[model samples]
Target: MAHDVQLEAITYETKEEVPQELKEKKLSWQKLRRYDSLDLESRSIPGHHHGHHSKALTRSLIFRLAFQSIGVVYGDVGTSPLYVFASTFPNGIGNNDDILGVLSLIFYTITLITVIKYVLIVLKANDNGEGGTFALYSLLCRYAKVGFIPNQQAEDRDVSNYELELPSGRAWMASWLKSALEKSMFAKQILLFATMLGTSMLIGDGVLTPCISVLSAVGGIQVATTKVTQDMVVWISVVILILLFLIQRFGTDKVGYSFAPIICVWFALIGGIGLYNFIQYDPAVAKALNPKYIIDYFKRNKKGAWVSLGGVVLAITGTEALFADLGHFTVPSVQISMCFVTYPALILAYAGQASFLRMNNDLVKETFYKSIPKPIYWPTFVIAVLASIIASQAIISGTFSIIQQSLSLGCFPRVKVIHTSTKYEGQVYVPEANYLLMVACVAVTLGFRTTTNIGNAYGIAVVFVMTLTSCFLVLIMIMIWKTHIILVLVYILIIGSVELLYLSSVLYKFDQGGYLPVAFATVLMIVMYTWNSVFRRKYHYELEHKISPEKLKEVVGGISLHRIPGLAMFYSELVQGIPPIFKHYVANVPALHSVLVFVSIKSLPISKVPVSERFLFRHVEPKDLNVFRCVVRYGYTDVQNEQEPFEKLLIENLKVFIRDGFGLPQSVLSNGENGEEIMDVRQVEEDMQPAEIEREIEAVDKAWHAGIVHLIGETEVVAGKGSSIGKKILIDYAYTFLRRNLRESDDVLTIPHKRMLKVGMTYEL
Candidate 1:
């Protein structure tokens, strides 16, 4: 029956040479026209043309976005004023000189790190419009093949945004560096490790930010009323943290409107109060803006001031949020907010607190509240708490974004990612991550019981992440920006030196709560490393054991297998040929679906894949077999949960390919009647006069409706008999446990249970 069933291979005829009209058009125009011709109605092709809006940054949009960014982007950094002064003077200010010096340090730290490094320089390193550690790694990986995952395709590099001019002259050093990084496996592994370490620290930031921010804010209650005890403050802070995490499910969308206004009001109130206090108290505190005071501060206080640097670093603790949350707002908006609002307000606030401390040295323990006038204490305290919650919300959202990026890059385990906003693709909520963060925050709040110790932990996580970001930024400067070698070295030297100083200061307090983030980062690092290592090993094993498509085709041709009437979609990591699971399935079942598709989903290093360029399809050899190979590509930031829509779009595109023969090289039809003529896929399909092709299309549609079954390989990794006991324990115990407990194939694929079949196999790696 298989031999009797004959199928005609649909083919098209066209010129092999390029047309004169096509050659005459500019490259940019051609690209614009091509994107314009794509079907905008298809969700699969997220319009790449949306890039235009980013390019057209109007004045009104900048101010509006800058104001709006206050709520989300600057919340964490803005609330730092609540605790910086108190944390700095935990042992009480020694003299009037110490207050000025501390204020000076806070002023310069915020200016240098927050405004200069992050706002002016680091923001430029964002991957497309997306930001974060993984986004940086993604940008670097695009220039160099350092990513451990083997899923990237050639077309991934062909993305318009991915293209860059080759380095020349001194810039050749960058190309050489990229080549060196890619050539060494050890270098690749090290790069991967650094990225994971930074990401883990970011997760730690998520836990520590909330604990410190809210505890510090609520501690103001104790300052306002001496009746409040330390335990009461801890309990109250924990309650607020619980409520914050509880409301994560409703997402930031519902409450996002109020964030901007609340934050705007908070900043305005703080800035206004800082000015009022600066004038009313020691106006001479303005002398603290001098860099000489920072040196004088260390010279006078010695080790005490050195230890105080840990607390002083608190002023810039949320600096990373400026860059991490860059995706939510434009760089211009962030820069504007920082330079005009956040930067100036922070400087004045710290100076005003120092002025207040000069006269009332005993109130150093509660500087923020003590500095406030009696007439507005209650309202100011209320605004401070609200601002702290917003700050915590920003970091929590940031944590979700980072985890989502890690999942896409294969560095993190699969977890359910809930899209929190339809308008913003990057806004997401992970249930597992949310609960874990909440628990960790509560634990930290209860354990530390004070802002001073939590500030130590917070400083460690912040400085380490900043240090790692600087290291990564060095590579990005060389490879992506192609900066002059001297400039790159100087950039690293300056940023590295500053961050290392803060890191050392923070690390000095390891016994005094600094170990919290270290422990948190270590645990997260191990999990990420184990997951990525197992994933790489499994993929390599599959590659080594994979059967060639030609061999599978010959074997199928020789056997009298039953041809079933339905579409079978085989999901595999292998992109090129038949997977071993397919061979195993055919050997056992002795049958094949009427239409077979080997599908591979790939995550590219870019921030997003355009909808028109998302799917790449080709017919497997011996077209009569009715076999097709499809690769669905996504950028790390792209949404990947549309399984049903993805399937439907693939089928629709495949039908167009079948009728119009567009995927085949020689089959591209060009209408030469006019230079302005546009070739539409639907029009080409309609122009095709093959009756048999139409019949096949209808039959395939019928088969699709009959049922589309998803076949996935369920592979178990175990050590071979020849392997060491350590390997056995690692694979059979740790890896297997993770696989069993983590999300399964159906969850990742979003495949319905009734239409899915898992074929089990074992691999000894």
Candidate 2:
């Protein structure tokens, strides 16, 4: 029966295993369809248009997004003015001339790092409109086979927007670089580890940003009057952090809408106040914008200036959030918001503080609040606190987005992800991550208890993330943009030197407080590495243990089992062959379902898969077996919780397949050898009687109604007898601990407890 099955039954053998006889055969149906067993590429990319510039966007919409982006993308960077000056001169200003030099560093750092590196360059490296370290890694994976996961197949490359656009010979350097990255296992591991380390550090930024931003804002109470003690401010900031994270379940859409106006008002007030101070105090202080001051100030201060860079880098702390949050906005909007609004406001804010310091150098610690006119001090203080909260909110949401992406890529443990907006696919809320971040933020605030200490930790996280972004962006420019090698070298010479300088300064302060993010990142990297390593091993085990059609028939024949009435949906991660767990289930169970469907839920690297192209169907061999394989592909941002609609669509596609006679070739149906004749599937459909098609559809409908049971494999991992101690510690201990503690596959899928059947098994990796 298996041998007699039609050519439409897609075989599950690798390319090397397929015989020349099978390769020569083709059907009329294969000619009509865009996809076939031999060719899997799509005619068009799904739900995404690729270009450096966004398509079909209006100027007004860009401006509107620009306005909204201020609340989300710029909040963290914008709030830097509240603490940068204070942190820079922690021991108070030495010479009035030092103010000019510090201001020069602030100006050049924001322009070089934020405006040029990010807004102009790194933003263009986005993968199908999604941005981040993972997006960059995904982009690299598309161009080259450097991804750590071994589960990717040829069909994965067929996903829309996943195709590689070959560069011309002009980019020979890039071509050489790509070849090197693909061939070197050691290099691939380093790239993967660095990307993970960057992501872990970003998560650390999420915890520290809120701690310092809120504390600095509330510290204005001490400046306003002596009534508010430092401890009181710490407790007050803790309360605000608790309240800020509590509202995260409302998601970015609501939070952005509510916070946008407050942030706008805050930016306006600071800009206005800065201009006033610049005019009233010392207009001559504008000379600080000269590059020479940066040189002279360093010469004058020596080691003190280098250490002050630990504080100077704070001016650009939120730069990562700008690129990380690009998925939520257009490049034009982020660029306009930064270049026109956020950039100017920060400059004037720092300038006004510098001008005031020129006259009253004694108030360096109190520069921001002291520079404000007494009449509006109280009102400005209120807005400062609100802006700080908004800044905290933005980074927290960005953290959730990154973790959700990691979970989809199998780099993190399973967690509950709630889609917060119906219109925007990127808006998501992770309940578990949110609470954990909140707790970490509170603990840090209580432990450090001052803005200066937290500022040390904050600068380390920020600079380290920036350094990693530069490294990733360099590769992207070479391999993706195919930029000239000379220009890439120049970029490294300039940006690389500045970031390394700051990196050294922060490392100098490791004992003061900089150890926090390092500790956080190390722990997170271990968790991620453990989960991803175990997942890849398990997938390989299934791939190696796959059962052939002959073996499957033997098992069924030996069971002598009754064909029960409903449909059994066996879920696994394997895309091609039947998993070993299915054989284990059949051997132990007394009965089998009449219709069996093997369902594989796969996550593609793209942002969203179109509904029309979501399901790929393949009939298993043996016409009487009634076994089918359905590979449901989803983009990383696509919602997968709609169970009823998913079931309806699956059943409907199966009915269509049956009605068309599985698109059978004429030779197979008529017992001719080697597909000597061909018949189109449309002709077969036309020949079928309406009643016969209806009866076939009715049988499937009845089976579906009889009750669908979801079969999920619950596998445990242990080291093989031949394995060493390291394998045992990694698999038996770390993997097992994470598997038992984290959310299970059934829970993440929202499978009902009554309908889910767990088949337990163990694997010796």
Candidate 3:
């Protein structure tokens, strides 16, 4: 069956590389209108054209990034030493063999899952330099037609960094998978659900990580003195969590610098202590590095060892951050820090704990604190608490980032995103999200009260996220990298099996507090899915019911209607033809703006759009009508500064377009910034009279000085009369409630009420 699309929709061809001859010609207004069908590719615009990893780094910078990554990327997993041993034997160890077996599992799991699977393989699959579930989805969408929304344009593929490299050989599996995803809407929905589920699990993980990490670190207070009670520990954790979240407004530049050195000292201290304990207590603990111990562990303990994986998987809790933070640091820097510092420190720490367990089996519940040497116990305890706080801060910031990305892609509701640092692009603070997280973190700390119960909940979110990453990676390997079928299966058999084992163990403990994250993620998934569904349905409706060119001409040509004396920017989601809301406005109001622009704000999959190429302009047919369509594109990570008024920028860019025509290079306008030289009309166009171009520029300036009014369509989405009960409930109730409460468009744009004109409409989808 063919998809239903409006027959009157205008289509344009986009070219990747502009022709040199076309660039040299001087185009008249009539000729310029003809060239508009080329989608403005002739303008020699400069952008961040290189891929994310294309830049070269100095030795000092690489080392600096590696050092900085210690605090931001490795904190969560680094602090895992404080709780791993205690969580593993919550019911007490059966014997020394169980210790050795669990130690072996930890060694291989970290080595295989965190080191080999993530650092070496999955990090390479990053979308241009960004990593996350959505980053992978963005990469796949570039390679195949698997996006859920059907409004993606051909010109979006012309982005400099949106590159694809097809395999030379005929890989049947890759072809088949791509075909299935494109042809079936069911397959696309499943893919979107999986991506949203993974994202939700990460957010859920964000909430649980701070609770468990802070509690485990503060739990050390009990071991330090006999007077401290469990209630005191919980209260101290709550206090620390509140302070940690309170400092998020300061951003990473202020906080991350101080944290790096402290985390560096923390890793060195733990590694040194682990080495000391390994030799002083028992050198035989080195034997657990052998893989055979893992196999023997399962044979003897059987189900007990299997169930212990829920605790064992906690060793690499922050593995996802390694990739998620790749945008903040280079791959070489992350690899350097992991291989030389973090990987070895973690191994020795676990080995030392296992060695101490061999001689003192009674201290299994308090292994980390009890095993610490007496001389540095207090200092180590202090550093442990600070390190856990830093770990919590990292995840909290990451949650804010993912939510912002979701908002940009239309999968999440509108939230006020404050760019916390002017220097850094990724540092953002969402006040509502932060306050809600603080409350949730405090609630989890008070409710669980113990790290063991929280660990059960923590492992489910972590392992499930890991499993989803593996699933996305398999599809990425096939579709993006074009890897052979055999190599892909080997990855599944090795990495996939280990994550499944951990996943099953975590699910086994679901009744014992593991359902917290699952329940949280389920709620988040519904909200995200509901928002995206209605968002797309509304866009589809606009596309189908848009006013055709003939109707648009008739509406404007009426004898009763008159043109107002200013520019009116009609904002809508449609890129082609007049939006139906405009026709409705003309019928009731009987007047139109002298200069009209149908502005469509779009978000792309790339990280940033070049300023020179930001504003794309096309004439609404009948060039003398003084009507145009402008599509402004922003990337997912791009931030629009409120200080720079959107209307002023549009007017300035439009002037450059009218003065230079479509054939001139963008460099001629000095990137549309103010105080640049304006070219003489005689130098650019020989056919058009110089006076005519001057008049157009003067009229645009007059319109700007006269007034600029933003015409935004306020939509109320409800279920149609013939809709089903379930559909009505979802659309009329749940969707309506969320839309009304979240941040509105005027608030985001900061437009004053006097200058803004809102056209309200109701849509029954």
Q: What is the lDDT of residue 92 in candidate 1?
A: 81
Q: TM-score each candidate.
A: 0.89, 0.91, 0.90
Best by TM-score: 2
lDDT of 1 by residue, 1-765 (tens): 000000111111211323344435554223323221111111112233322124788999999989878888888888888888878878887777988888888888887888878988999888777788887887777667777543223344445566444445656777789789888989988888888899899999999999988998998888878899999999999999999999999877665546999988888888888888899999999998788988898999988888888988888877888888887789999889888888878777887888888899998888889888899999999999999999999899889888877876676777777777876557778888999999989988888898888898888999988998898988888777778888877876877788888888889999998898899989888777676777777776766677766786785665578888899898886654556777778878887788888887767667777776777676665656777777676777766564327778889877876765433322334455654334444443454447857865886797798789999877878888898887777788877777788777667666778989888888878
lDDT of 3 by residue, 1-765 (tens): 001111121344334433443344554223443234235433333232434437778999999989988989999999999999888889887877888888998999999999999889988987767788878877776677776532235445555565555555746767888898889988877877888898899999889999998999888888989899999999999999999888888776677656889898999988988898899898898888787888888898889888989999999999999988887888889999999999999999999888899999999878888889999999999999999988998898889888877775578877777777776667778787899899989999899999899999999999988998999899988876778789998999989998998999999999999999999899999889788877778777887788877787788877899987888888876666567888878878898878888887767666556666667777565555677778777666666655546788888888777765643432332211343343333444553456776787787787778888989877888899999999898899888888888778776555678989888888878
What's the ranking of the predictions by lDDT, best on top?
2, 3, 1
Query: How do the candidates rank by TM-score, highest first?
Result: 2, 3, 1
lDDT of 3 at 708: 86
lDDT of 2 at 630: 79
Task: Please provide, for model 2 over 518-544, each residue's C-alpha lDDT reduced to its tens digit, 9 standing for 90 to 100.
Answer: 999999999988888877888778778
- Where is model 3 more than 4 Å wrong at Cα? 1-53, 150-152, 170-173, 557-559, 588-592, 643-645, 663-689, 752-754
Pick by TM-score: 2 or 3, better one? 2
lDDT of 2 at 241: 99
Clashing pairs in 1: 45-611, 46-611
Candidate 1: 10-residue stretch with minimal lDDT? 1-10
